[model samples]
Target: MMNNKKPEVWLRGELPGISTLLQPAAHALLQSKEEVFKYTEGFPEFLLWKRPAGRASVGFHLQHITGVLDRMLTYAEEQQLSEKQFEYLRNEGAEIPEIKIDHLTQAFTEKVAQAIDIFKNTAEEKLTQKRTVGRKQLPSSLIGLYFHAAEHSQRHIGQMLVTISVLRNQNN
Candidate 1:
């Protein structure tokens, strides 16, 4: 049977307002949001923190994706991370019983939207402008930060899928 699912975000054509240079990064963020929701549908809250085979938990990936995107975008804007952002980073992946999968997924979705908005507003000429990351202030560029946010999100999403699959199979 022919596949009835919609094409991936990158295949769906350019997003309005995003620069051509930043289209791929925007697409990746959009795809990451979709995959997070798709894979986490009906995922048990209790399993969110399960670390099968000592790999990172699904909860960690969800939180990290949101946190990292926020941080990367902040750096892209050439600003220091707020105290709240730093606190969030420190708490990522902690087994907070009150936090649900839906909450985490929604946060990730919102972060992606925020990133897209930033991408849309970013001028093409500034993509190569220098930026620094973290306490050590490692050198980077605007485009570098955006691309890292996208690719890093995808990497964690892959890890999350694996963790979810392992947890589900074990529970089943």
Candidate 2:
């Protein structure tokens, strides 16, 4: 066996356009994207919305991670969530008819790409600027929002993986 697997994104050296300060966040987001695709590969669509032990379903996790990235990045840019974003947030985990595993995974992939682009455009100075989150307008720094988005994605990825494993085992 060749045993060939690439190191996690952070260990692969700095991404070209992402600032050093934002590298960890970027790396985490990229790693989350990779893991989402890897773990969800060939996962049966029938189990996508199945929840065991009242925990969130794999479908919800996928939708949530993507939605959080969008909302968090928007806050990082010192903006409020748009109507569409709010609607997406409200719908995060709701089962949809005929949704496939790949559809959810691809949406997450695209959201991660968009997040990276935002990271590249964000100047280092802006990272420390004040920002507000949600309608409550609670205080946070720009960097805080970005980092939260990354870590939040990682959190959901872990939950999603566990859900997937349990679901598969149950079906078997």
Candidate 3:
């Protein structure tokens, strides 16, 4: 069911409550979630933190995906990052023995669900509304943040896939 042979997500037609312009972002996020879940299956715990060829670890990608989504969505809502969330961001790649691949993947899955819930409540008209991001207060539209969140999540998933491949190949 997770094969890439299926049609691209954006062509699947409208998702019920997401704005028309925002549907592609939502679909990409959902597909990324599924692909990550599949890609991570049976991923070895011992290799979770391996920085193959000086690349970011699979663990980092997993943590960053969820953290970035939460932060981006918070920016979209016109809110500053909370103290706990900032701490979370700072600790993304710490090598904790207990942090297995499944734990990280499940965290991402939950974050994806949270993102979908927010997408449902977002007004179609708010897509163009400007929002301030982070301490620098960089300008961005609501749709931009969500779109970035989707693309960023997929980007990390791609990196994780490469890391997994490298790790597996090294083991063989």
Candidate 4:
């Protein structure tokens, strides 16, 4: 007879509601950060901004993702965010730096690691508490915020790939 009891698992000193799902999602997001850097290797900064007129350069999209992740991490840690970042969190269109492709890649990697470390060290129970991020109220659960970060990162990664391909084609 098969046992009906659920297997016990823990992360960050607490058991995640869906530990199995969260672990792999976190790993995949981390991998994507590396992949984005690898994808743009040796590419010229000019190409990062050489998109069709009225379109955001690949650089802008990447920087946006970095800012978003940083914002979420700040909220998760209950830390104060920059005045600019706070405005961005409240509004849809926020100004972010025009990051060079290479530098943005490095920044993304570093931010990802920092966010992951914060998430990993947080206790399981703490993951669910709601925290005020900047001025926007958000649920305190780290898991939810982690998921948001991963999904947001993935979306930008996809955009970066498309932008790169378009720029490469334009070059040829």
**TM-score of every model?**
0.97, 0.97, 0.93, 0.73
lDDT of 3 at 29: 94
Worst 10 residues of 4 by lDDT: 6-15
Best by lDDT: 1
lDDT of 2 at 63: 93
The order by descending TM-score is: 1, 2, 3, 4
Better of 2 and 4 by lDDT: 2
lDDT of 4 by residue, 36-139 (tens): 86678877776766655556577766777778888878777777788887665454222333556667778778888777676567666776777665456644
Regions more than 4 Å wrong, model 3 = 1-6
Across residues 48-108, which tens digit of lDDT does each residue of candidate 3 receive? 9989999999899999999999999899889999999999999999898888888888898
Compared with the true structure, model 3 gives a TM-score of 0.93
| Model 3: residue 129 alpha-carbon error in angstroms | 0.7
Evaluate model 4: give its lDDT. Answer: 0.68
Expressed as tens digits, the lDDT of each residue in 83-145 for candidate 2 is 999899888889996777888889989999999998999899989999999899999999999
For candidate 3, the lDDT comes to 0.90
